[model samples]
Target: MKAAVVQEDKTVKVAEKAVPKLQPNEILLKTVSVGLNPTDWKHVKNFSRPGDIVGCDFVGKVVEIGSEVPVGEIKEGEVRWGFTRGGVDGERGGFAEYVAVDWDLSSVVPSNVTPQEASSIPIPFLTSVQALYIHLGVPEPPEKVSGEPWILIWSGFTAVGRYAIQLAKLSGFKVATTASEKNWAKLKEYGADVVFDYKDPDVVKKLKEATGDKIEYGFDCISEKGSVQLSQQAFRPEGGRLILLLPTPSESELPRPDVKTSTTLAYMMLGTPIQWGKITLPAQPEDRACFVRWTKITTELFAKGAIKPLDVHVVGDLDKIQEALDMLQSGKHSTKLVLNVS
Candidate 1:
């Protein structure tokens, strides 16, 4: 098997590696396509070792199933898509000819979605699910939310922000988001009720005025670059909860003491502790349970055309992995970049 492996100098190189042995609760997948994300590059620069595999989001066909997997839950030849913590192990990441994934963390691709499109869903979509329903307390879809509450999503054009906007609207909440002027229309199309230019000096004020200080919940897709401060300020004076995709800033760094903050780690959906640098996030079975439940719900949503996959730009195969990573790191692509691996 050939995989994109990290180098000691923080670069990705395609190298030959042995196929992973399947675990009792896992499934062996023949790779179809993989998606590129900012985390992939970050892992290379920050956490990965010389031999770590370097990709996360993937769609693959089940070549083999584990003995412990429930009968009929997943079958050989079924197309499944999910994400793993990339840049950690030599055989575990997505940019490979073969992958072994936990059966519980993977989901069947909807009949209508292509493999490239399905590869773009797992990380961003599930991150939005955790941020809105699990931490922010927004009601999940198919449940009635009493009022037209407003929730702010910072960096609305990002993959996670786009999904958050759509999910919030589906739950009957009015959505407000920050993005550049160029993406305002697309954000609105994704179900954002109001879009503010994040570069504007009065962005927070405009959001407060537009929502009448009723913005109680927020999700910060880009936690750095003053985004957290702006998102916190947009909340009402009484304050509310804010969910972040990165580490939450310390109390003194945050502008408001009233706003409660928590970070969403999508890797936790694997039901395993994540070790990055000196921090070790323990496994939360409850988070995994929520993820498993929503995976089914999201599949139904896709079938009903209620949720749409992000637009994707195919960037060729495994050899193009470094080029795709460079594009993502350049912050130049608005559409998801996918690599055809099969």
Candidate 2:
């Protein structure tokens, strides 16, 4: 197999490596499409363990299944989309020609979606699912739970933000979100109650005014310094919930007690719980159940179009992995980037 490995020089190089064997609960996916995220490079520069395989979001055909995998849940040659953890990605990653997938993290791609489209779902969709369902207590999809408890999603056009907006809407929560004016119309079409320009000089003030402090929950997909502060403002001063996809303040910058905040690690989709700066936390039985339920629910939601696949900036070959990574880091693409591995 050939995978993109992160070298000590911080360069990504495609190198040949042995194929990985599956554990009793894993499956082998021969990569058909790979989604490149900004994290692909961020993980390389920051969280990297040298020589680590460097990507995670993928869609492929199942070539092998573990003994413990439930019969009929998935089959050889069936197409599936999934994501895996970083840092030690050699045995399992979308950047390679093949990856060992935890069966729980893999889901069948609906017939209506192409492999390239499915490849763009796992990281963003699971990140949104975990943030909304697992942490913030948002109602599950298919049950329309609407009312005064509105939600705020920062960076509405981001891959995760895009899914977060749709999922929140599907769950029946009214939403207020921020993005560029160019994206405002589509965000609204995707179900946001209101869209404000994130670059506005009064962006936070605008969000505060638009939602009337009634924004009781928020998912800060951006989590850059300003993003946290703004997301904090959107939630009611009286109290609310917030989920971040990036590193938050050093306990010192924590928010008001009335307002609860937590960060999500999407790799948890594989049934493991991970804490930043520290690795190797054991999977919690309850969390494993949470992730499994998330997979099943979202699989249905996606197939029915309750959750739409993201628009993608498609890169046509694995040979251009570095080119795709550079494009992601350039921050110009408003869509997810998928590498056609075949």
Candidate 3:
């Protein structure tokens, strides 16, 4: 298989590598599409090393399942979408033509969604799902808005932020969001009742004006610039909950407030308690169960078209992986970038 290896910082090379085999609880998948994320290049450049093949979000057909796998419920030929941990096992990752998927992290891709679309969902959707529905006690996806809470997603144009908006809408939140100017209208279509431009000098004022100063729930999709700071302001004293997709501050970075804050390592959160327990710090059963229920809910929303995948910037071929990465880093791509691996 021809895979892109990060030979060093800002350097990548297409090289042939042996295909990976599945472990007892894993599934072997022939990659059809790979979603490029901000982290892919960040890790590659930061490490300045050759080892990590860091692409995560993926969608493909399961070619083989382990003997211990109970895939009969999912079926062998089903299309699926999911996140993979960085550096799966000992090898690099989904940048290649194949990946050994841990069964627990995988989910069936709706037949109606293309591989490119499916690939875009796993990481971003799971990020929003884990953060809002599980961690913050937001309602489950694909459910009617029966008593749903209000949520303010701080970056509605981001892939994760886009998913957060759609999920909140589908699960029954009166959603509000902040985005770049051009995306404000699109965010409205995605179900944000109010959309504010983060670039506006009065962005925080606009948010407060829209919510009437009773801010309670927030999802901070951008870690830097004005987004994080404004989010802190929007959070209500003790009722506030903020979930960050980026690295959250230690006690030092946290504001002295009664608000609750959490960060998610989304792929790892899909595990069963046993799987999580193996890592030494397991998810509480309650947390694990909420994730499971939300997973099913999000999957159903995708299947029913209640929550749509973000419009993707489809980079034409695997050979253009570098260009795609460059585009993402340059902040030129407005939507998720999907590599046509097939």
Candidate 4:
């Protein structure tokens, strides 16, 4: 097998390697499309992490299954997609031609979508779904809009932010978002009731001013200066919830002291009954499975056309993985970038 290996000098290259051997509950996937994300480049820059394979979102056909996996998990061949653990030091990711993930980490690809489209949905969509519906304790009551509940999604054009807008709309919240002027129209098309340019000097104030300061839920997809600052302003006075995709550093000073804040790094735990305060750090695999189930449900919603994958920039094949990463790193690609892994 040929894999994209992150070498000791912190560079990526194609190299020959043996395919991964699966464990009892693991299934082998023949990669068809792999999605590139920020973490793919972040990992390579932060560490001279050798032999690392870094692509998480994958759409692939099942080629092999471990003997111990349930009969339901395997088919002679089944198209499936999901995110593998792409933590800097975690398991080999889905970048190469094959990936072996626990059955819980994989879901059958939605039949109505093409592999490239399906590949763009899982990682960011799952993360957004987990962040909003789970970590923030938003009511999951069937969509009943008593009036628009002002919910702000900072950076609403990124993959996660795009899904955040759609999911909130599906759940009956009126969405307000911050994005570049170029993406504001697209954000409105995704059901954002109001959109603000992040570049505006008073972007956060503009968002609050437009919504009459009634924002109750905030999902910060961007963890940098813009998102953090804007979300702090957008959250309501009391009972307001803020969820950050990046873990809040222990030493970090929070701008909003009145609002309850939690980080969503343990993405799988979102939207479950488990309280955020009770969760143990360095999550167990079973704990992670909660997120897996969350993703499956979201994928089903997407297939039924309840939620949708946002604009996908398909940049050809696995050989172009580095190019995809460079696009994301350069902050040039507005929509999700998917690579057909043929």
Candidate 5:
């Protein structure tokens, strides 16, 4: 098997390695397409294990399933895509010809979603769901939303932000969002009722005014400087909850006191809390349960066209993984980037 591994000095090189051995409930996947996220580059920069595989989020064909797999739900040669972390320490990721993941973590890709498109679904989409339903306590998604409970997703054009907007809408909240000028209509098409330009100086005020400051939920997909600060202000004066993809920045960039805040780190999906900086957080019992519920719901949504994948820009084969990561790191591609792992 061939996989991309981080070298001692933190560079990725395609290297030959043996295929992973599967456990009783694990499925062996032959990689088809792997998605790139900003975290991929971050892991590369903080290379820990010299030769560990270096990617996450993939769509692949099942070469084999463990004996314990549910009888009719999945089978050999089936195509699947789901959430699993890769490319750090000794944990194998999806950047290789073959990888193994527990069966509970994946679902068969529906016909409507190509391997490439499905590849981009896991991390960002799951991140949004975790941020909303788990971190922020938004209700479960209903088939038909009755009321116009509004929530604001700052940076809504982002991969995670788009998912947040759609999920918020499905979960029965009226959605408002801020994005660059070019992404307004795109966000609207995804169910954002109102879209504001985040680049505008008065954006927070404008968004609050548009929603009557009743917006109580926010997801900061782009946690750059000033993003959380601006997003927290859009909530009503009574106070609301905000979710950050990363830690809230320094005291200088802190959001207002009225906004209760939390973070949704997707890695918590691994069933263990991460040792981030000096913080030793406890594991989240909700993440795995949420992933199970969400995988069932979102896969059905994908099959029925209730939700859709972002446009995927396929960047060729396994050897081009580095190029794909570079594109994401440079912040050049507007759509999701997928690498065909032939």
Candidate 6:
């Protein structure tokens, strides 16, 4: 097998590696396509150990099932896609010819979805699920709240924000989101009721006034570059919940003292503790349960064409992984970058 392994110099190189042996509850996947995310590059630059594999989102075909896997739960030849905590393990990350994934963490890909499209969904889409239902307390789809409450999604053009907007709308919330002027129309198409330019100095005032100062919940997809402050300020004076995709800023950095803040990590959906440097996040079984339940629902929605994937740009195969990572690091492309690994 060949995998993108981190070097001591903090660069990723495709190197030969042995195939991973599966655990009792895991499945062996022959990698098909994988997605690139900021986490992949950040891990390389900040946290990953030398020789660790360096990717997260993947779509693959099940080649073998573990003995403890329930009968008929997952079968060989089924297309499955999910995310893993990449750059932590030398043998378990997604940017490899073969990957061993827990059966519970991976979902069956809808017949209508291409492997490239499915690859882009796991990390960002699941993050949106956790932020909306688990943290922000937005009612999940098929369970709409009355009165159509407004929820602002900071950075609507981001992969997480795109899914958050759609999911919030499906739950009968009126969605307000911020993006560049170029992305306003597309964000609206994704179910944003109002789109504001994030670059505008008065964006927070505009959003607060547009929602009648009733924006009670927010999902900040980009937690840096003043996004968190802006998102907190957009909330009503009474304040509400705000979900951050990254580590929460210091209390002094947030403008609103009344706003409740919680940080969400999509990797926790694997139902395992994560240790990055001195930071340790405990396992949350409830988060994993939410992922398992909603993944099935979202898969059904994908099959019925009720949900859509972000735009994907397939860069190439395994050999192209480094180039794709560079593109993501440069922040030049809006489309999801995918690599065919089969």
Provide the global lDDT of candidate 6 against the true structure.
0.90
- The digit string of per-residue lDDT tens for model 6 on 110-213 reads 99899999988998999988998888776777788789988989998988888888888888889999988998888989999999999999999999889999
Candidate 5 Cα errors over 4 Å, as ranges: 143-146, 250-255, 277-280
Q: Which prediction has more favorable TM-score, 1 or 3?
A: 1
Q: In candidate 6, list every pair of residues with a backbone clash.
A: none
**RMSD to the native, candidate 2?**
1.9
Q: Which stretches of candidate 4 lie over 4 Å from their true place?
A: 87-91, 140-147, 249-252, 266-280, 284-289
Per-residue accuracy of model 5 over 41-96 as CA lDDT, tens digit each: 88788644688888888888999889888887677888888756676545477788
Per-model TM values vs. the true structure:
0.98, 0.93, 0.88, 0.89, 0.95, 0.98
- The regions of model 1 sitting more than 4 angstroms off are none
Cα lDDT, all candidates: 0.90, 0.81, 0.73, 0.74, 0.83, 0.90
Span of ten consecutive residues with least summed lDDT in model 6:
136-145
Per-residue alpha-carbon lDDT of candidate 1 for residues 1-342, written as tens digits (9 for 90 to 100): 999999878889899999989999999999999988888999999889999998889999999999999988998999988888889897678889899988888888889999999988989999999888888776677884778888899999999998888999998889999999999999889899999999999999999999999988889999998899889999999999899999998998999989898899888887889897898889989789988887688788987889999999999999998899999999989999999999
TM-score of the candidate numbered 5? Answer: 0.95
Better of 1 and 5 by TM-score: 1
RMSD of each: 1.0, 1.9, 3.5, 3.9, 1.8, 1.1
